[model samples]
Target chain A: MDRQAWTTLFHRLLFTSAVWIVLSGTDAKALAVGAFAVPAATWLSLRLLPGRDRLVLWRFLRHFPSFVGGSLQGGVDVARRAISPGMPLLPGWVEVPVRLPDGGRVALGAELSLMPGTLAAGVRGDRLLVHLLDTDAGFENAIPREEAAIAAMILGTGKEVGP
Target chain B: MNDLATYAFTSIGLFFFVAGSVGFLRFPDVFSRLHALTKADNLGLGFIALGIAFQAESWRLVALLFLIWGLMLLAAGTMSQLIARDALRERDGR
Candidate 1:
């Protein structure tokens, strides 16, 4: 493997080891099992889905707070609308042009679906078909902002990081 | 103080869980119901995990709780997309 692939393998191994430690705790006996299991799992993971893109950690960290805040708002918004007397809903679909690469697009779709008032339904060509809980809920602005964030996270700002 | 926090957090979590269920029953279509179920339940689980984390005796247990919540968020986000996509495809008769 090249340097980038080596880096990906290292990161994946580190991640899998961390997961094993978290799941099994720090007991020597558990770690003895993990000594065999962790590498096996990491190898299996790489075989199943080799890393295509590197995540920009600082960008993700910068966006993490807002993402959490948005998810909280989304949960509360849906709950309030659910129990309200009027049951106000203007559900419909809107197609937004997608600019990110494949991995970034998947991340964008997942993130947008978890955000307030929007659910990513499907993809048609280069446009993402989004279902809005309320068309007037101002998602016209939200989706683009989210897309920009995801791009920054996956693609970086004007300088791509991964091979 | 920790007990009080646990109670408060869990109660809020329970409220969201109940609200999610209500929305699931009340929403008109599959997409909307998924919107309710996934979003609300994710938040609910997060709060409950936070509450439980407070009671955890060790930092490892707390970390595990956080990991669980993070996994739930990813799972719910991806699962909602898959379900929504399938529903959309079915609706379009494709």
Candidate 2:
């Protein structure tokens, strides 16, 4: 394996080990089992989905707070709209032009789905089809903002990559 | 103080869960129901995990709770996409 591949393997090992410790705790017997299990799982993971782009941790950390807050707000918004007697909803679909690569696009879709009133339904051509609970809920601004954040985290560059 | 936080968080979490269920029953279509179930239930689980974390005896258990919540968020996000895609396809008669 090349240096990049090795680095990816090492990171995967570290992550799988952390998951193992979380799952089985730090007991000696559990560690003994994990000794066999962790590496096997990491190897299987690499085989199934080899690392291509590394997520920039600091970038992700910087954006994490806002992402959490947005999703929380999303939950509250949906709950409020759902329980209201009027049941105010203006549900519809909107297409946002996709600018990032596949990995960044998937991350963007997932993050947008967790944000207020937006669920990414599918991709068409170079645009993402997002379902909105309310067309006028200001998703116009939110979607682009989230796309930039995911692009920064995955690609390490905030610049728009495509026209 | 800890008990107070636990109770408060748990109550808020349960409230969200109930709201999600209500939304599921009230929402008119599959897409709307998906919104309620995925978003509200995830936040509900997050708060409930936070509440449990407050009462956890060790940091390890707290970490475990957080990991579980994070995993759930990822799963819910991905599943919502798959479901929404299928629903759209079905509606289009594809």
Candidate 3:
């Protein structure tokens, strides 16, 4: 395996082991089995999904907290909207032009959809169709900032190969 | 104290679930309904997991709760995207 491949494999092994630890409740006997099982699973996974994106750990670490915060805030915002006696909803679709490549764009779309007020509708060329629960929710600026964060974390080296 | 915290978290979680249901029923269109369900459920489940975690005996259970919530979030996001895309396509076709 090449350097990149090895790196991916190692990361996958670490992740699978952690999963096993969590799932087995850190039981010593369970971990004994997991020591072997996790590596085998990682190997199988690598074979099934080869040549995937190289995950930059530092970038992921940096933005992960913000992502969690955003998601929590998203939940609160939507909960408040849902419970309001006077439902204040101004539903509209907005097309935002994004510079991120195809993969990054998809990631951004998925991320945006998970948020409280925004749902990504479709991708047409360089623009993404986004549905807003309320246009007044200030997504115009918010989306771009998220786009930048996603690009930095997942895009790796600021290079776009396609789309 | 532990019981109080657990009750508080669980109530909040149930409250969000109720709110989401109301939004789902009252919202006019598919897109809006999707918004309500996805957002409220994400938080609802999170709070519920947190409540359960507080009462859990081991750290592993807490980790498992978080893992479940993370997986739910991913599923919600993917499912919403698929539904929204289909709805948009149908609208365009009309």
Candidate number of the best TM-score: 2
Candidate 1: give the clashing pairs.
none
Query: Which window of 10 residues has the lowest lDDT sum in candidate 3 chain A?
Result: A154-163
Q: Note the DockQ of each predicted structure.
A: 0.83, 0.81, 0.66
Q: What DockQ class does candidate 3 belong to?
A: medium
Cα error, candidate 3, residue A147 (Å): 0.9
lDDT of 1 by residue, B1-94 (tens): 8998899998999999999999999999998998898889988999999998889999989999989989988888888999999999898899
lDDT of 3 by residue, A1-163 (tens): 7898787877888888888888885678997898789989898888875646555679878888888787777777776777788888899988988887666777788788766589887788778999998998785557877887777766565444322
Candidate 1 lDDT, A1-163, residue by residue in tens? 8999999989999989999998999899999999999999999998877777668778999999999999999999999999998988889889998888876777888888779989987699989989988888886568888888887787667333211
**Ten contiguous residues minimizing lDDT sum, candidate 1 chain B:** B71-80
Arranged by TM-score with the best first, the candidates are 2, 1, 3
Q: Model 2, A49-163: lDDT tens per residue?
A: 7787667779999998998899899999999999999998989998989888876787787888888999988888889989999888876568888888888888788776533
The best candidate by DockQ is: 1
* DockQ ranking, best first: 1, 2, 3
Q: Model 2, stretches more than 4 Å misplaced? A: none
| Cα-based lDDT at residue A63, candidate 2 | 99
The lDDT per prediction is: 0.88, 0.88, 0.82
